[model samples]
Target chain A: MKAAKIVFGLLAVTFLMAPLVTILPLAFTSSDLLSYPIRSFSLRWFEELMISDAWRMSIVNSLVIGAGATLLATVLGTLVSLGLRRSFAFSGILKSALLLPMVVPAVILGVGMQITFIQLGLVNTHVGVIIAHTVVALPFVIVSVSGSLAGIDMRVERAAMSLGANPLRVFGHVTLPLMLPGVLSGAVLAFATSLDEVVLTLFVAGPNQRTLARQMFSSIRENISPAIAAAAFVIIVGTVVVAGLVLLFRAAAQRQKPSTVTV
Target chain B: MTASMATSRASGRGSTTGRDGSMAASSARVAAMNGASAPFIALEQVEMMFGTHRVVDQLDLTITRGEFVSLLGPSGSGKTTILMLLAGFLQPTAGSICLGGKRIDHLPPHRRDMGVVFQNYALFPHMSVADNVAFPLRMRRVGREEIEQRVTRALDMVQLQHLRDRRPAMLSGGQQQRIALARALVFEPSVVLMDEPLGALDKQLREQMQLDIRDLHRRLGLTIVFVTHDQGEALTMSDRIAVFNRGRIEQIGSPTEIYDRPASRFVAEFIGETNLMAGKVTTTGPDGSLIRLDSGEDMAASAADWPAAGNEALLSVRPENVTVQPVGTARRTERVNIMQAKVADSVYQGDHLRLHLDCGQRRMIARLDRQVADYAVGTQVDVVFQADNCRVIPT
Candidate 1:
């Protein structure tokens, strides 16, 4: 049974990783045309990504939009979670409504947002793309932050108030510090979400506001070069680095936790 | 503000004296000033309702300055609710609270200037012990030098200065509890409210902390309002105890008064283990009353609440007050009530023996020293108790 289970797990991992395994190595190929077997390895495709005007512009756009969306989503999501901490009669309904963007099809959200953006004169702008990305990223921030917020012992905040801290001071001194790990991880998730978003960005962005994901989509249709593979590699590595930082932060937080032994 | 600061500085200096010598002098001063002035904290007709479920109903309580009062009851008995109301965490639905003769019901918790110690210690995990102790002073914008001096003195009060640099997580439960105590006292608030602060500790640690807190209360002349479900803790640490039942106070008095003369059957059963005998008063006088038990026995009980003739009453007798003797060993006395019974069971405790006696249709228990001769099952014995030890409580 154990052997069968191990075989099943290997099959699942292979199935999940097959596309990344086939595509990532092409990023290092010397050939201009993307091929299955690499004749040689070179840094030329990566250099093309950095030196080409359109690719360089797209990468910068991705970073700008991702950071903006992450900042907006994290602030709004943390506020919503704090407001929802002490539940009211409509709290469940409000929470479900907040998370509706997660379960709703992105195509539907894109169409709706595109119409709304047009009415608000936000279409074909970086602000439009960032706002679009924040709509989808908000749910992840809310979920992560709410999980950590729930884990906090509210008595600690009460203790702060009893020690002569007003409401704002208590939040700054106790509540914010306790839930910081959650906020950091949520920001990372929000940035990653905005970095790779394609459907909504394609509908909302113009040619000048093209993001990395939109550039890669057009490249796949028009050229299919190794430069596209380099962009993918850059995104994958960025995500891994961000996730690693979050894990390090979590480990440090765990170390600072008090020991549970009763004396 | 200047006058209050001077008084606080004076008390801070008083705390620096030797523990033994200062305890005597401070406690005597406290006793002398206890009831001579108005109450330090007063709750008048306070009612707290949670969506129509009344947690505290028309409650009135007063704590004199320098008195340690414990709100004792079972869970859901409104004792913790009272503590929360006093701390300004939960506002009473109606009525008012006054501290130092000024209405404070509308103030927020931080503005109320009261310290609260939670059951789980609730120390900031990210802060060092000194920072936790210095939090209130920092909040008040004290100078850095004064903050350091006060934090050091507060940690010294709890004897935890050596662990000032450690986080709360690195400390044991007792150490964390002491840090919480130091943090609460560091500000020298007008009142200190503790909600079962030692509930998490083991029995031995709890007993030691009880003595520590009682000693601190005496030495510091602190007015503390403590809430605990443990009757023994209240009896040991409180100057007066308010026994709560069903969102109301059943009885409130000194420990001895509440124990020796519980006003109701609930107070009698809640405070300690007592054998309650149902009876009707046959005769009553200023000194005592005669009651006829339902099990066909006549017993004398001291007067309680002035029970008139033929009123239903309960006779409460502590187990330790009853003496068990061999059937023919005890002689009848005028003031002692003696009954003949058969030993149904005997439980050997470490320091005492619990004898279960079957007398007619009722069962009575007597706690005797372990050195007393053991009685076998079905052996005849005499159960003896003085009339003064048996309290008559209204049913």
Candidate 2:
């Protein structure tokens, strides 16, 4: 039975990792044909990605849009989480509405946003793409932040207040610091979500505002190049690094949790 | 707020002068001084309603400066609600609260200048012990040097100065509680409100902390409003206890007054173990009143609030007040009531024996000293109590 379980686990891992295994090595292939068996490995494709104007511009755009969307989403989502903590009549409905983007089809959101952006005269601009990405990234931020908020004891905030800290000072000194790990993880998730978003960028962005994910998508359709593989490699490594930092933050948070006494 | 500070400081000085005397005498002096002045904290007709449910209904309470008052009750009895109201965490639906004769009902919790220690300690996890104690001073924008000096002194007061660099998670429950106490007091606020602050400790630790808190209250001349469901804790630590039942105070008085002469049936049952006999007042006299029990026994009891003859009454007698003697060993004397009883059961406690006696159909408990001769099951005995030891409460 144990052997069968081990076999099944290995099969699952292989199935999940097969696509990355097949595609990543192509990024290091010397030939541009994208064949599996490479005669030699070269850094030419990586250098081309950095030197090409279209690819370089797309990389910069992705970073700019990702940072902007993460900042906007993290702030708004944390506020929404705090406000929703003390629930009112319509709070549940509002929360579900905010989370709608996570389940709604990305194509539908893209088509809807394209028309709205044009009406707002935000089309073909970096702001429009960032705003579009933020809408999709908000659910991840809210869910992460709300989880952290729930672990906190409300009495800690009250203790700060009783110790002569006003509302704003209590937030700054107590509540914000306690929930920092959650906020950091949520920001990472928001950035990763913005980095990979393609359909919304395709609908809302023009050629000048093309993001990395959009460029990769168009490259696959127009031409199969190793440089696209290099870009994918960079994104995958970047995501792993961000995820590692989040894990570190969570571990530190767990270690420092205050002892809760029960009577 | 400033006026309240002045009054508290004056009481602090007065207490310091009497520090060399006995604790009881010093506290009495403080109480006398406080009684001669206006109340430090006063709640006048305060009502707190939660939607359709009224948590605190038209309640009034007053705490004299330097007095430690405990709001004692069962859960849902509005004792904690009153504490929160006093701390400015919950606004009253009606009426007002005054500190040193200044109305403070509209002030926010921080502006009220009150320190509160929560049941769970509620220490900040991210802060060191010294920083936690220094939080109030930092919030007041005290200079860094003064903050350090005060934090050191506060930690010293709790005898936790060695643990100043450690986080709250690393401390034991008792140590964490001391940190919470130090943090609450470092600001030297006019009043300190504690909500079952030692409820999380074990029995021995809780008892020790109770003594420590009482000592602190006497030494610092602090006006404290404590809330606890534990009656023993209130009796041990409080100068005055307000026994609450269903959003109203059943009675409020000194611990001895509450225990020896409970104002109502609820207060009698809530405070400790007591034998309550349903009776009717048969005759009233200058010395005491005669009560005819429903079980066809007659007893004499002194009444704090005299009930007229032919009024319904309850006789409350603490078990320790009831003494058991071998049958016919002693004759009844004036102002003493005696009954022939059969010992149904006797449980040997550490320092005493709890005897359960049967007087006709009514059961009575007597706590006899361990040195007293044992009365086995079914042994005939006489149960005796003085009129002054039992109270006749009008029901």
Q: What is the TM-score of chain B alone in each candidate?
A: 0.93, 0.93
Score residue A158 of candidate 1 by CA lDDT. 90
Candidate 1: give the clashing pairs.
A258-B169
Q: Candidate 2, residues B184-215: lDDT per residue as tens digits? A: 98888888999999999999999999998887
Question: lDDT tens string, model 1, B1-395?
Answer: 11122222223224534333343334413432345656768899999999989989899998887778999999999999998888888989998899989999999999988889999999998888888888899999999898888887888888998888888888999999999998998888888899999999999999999999887776776778999999999999887899999899999988998999899999999998898999998888767778899887889887654577889888889999999888988877656888899999999999999999998888998999989888998999999999999988889
What CAPRI-style quality would you assign to candidate 2?
acceptable
Model 1 docking grade: acceptable
Best by lDDT: 2
- Across all models, the iRMS values in order are 6.1, 7.1
Residue-level lDDT tens digits of model 2 in A17-106? 999998898899889877778889998899989999999999999999999999999999999999998889999999999999999999
Query: What C-alpha lDDT, on a 0 to 100 scale, does residue A223 get in candidate 2?
Result: 84
Model 1 complex DockQ against the native = 0.49
Report how far residue B268 has shifted in candidate 1, in Å: 0.9
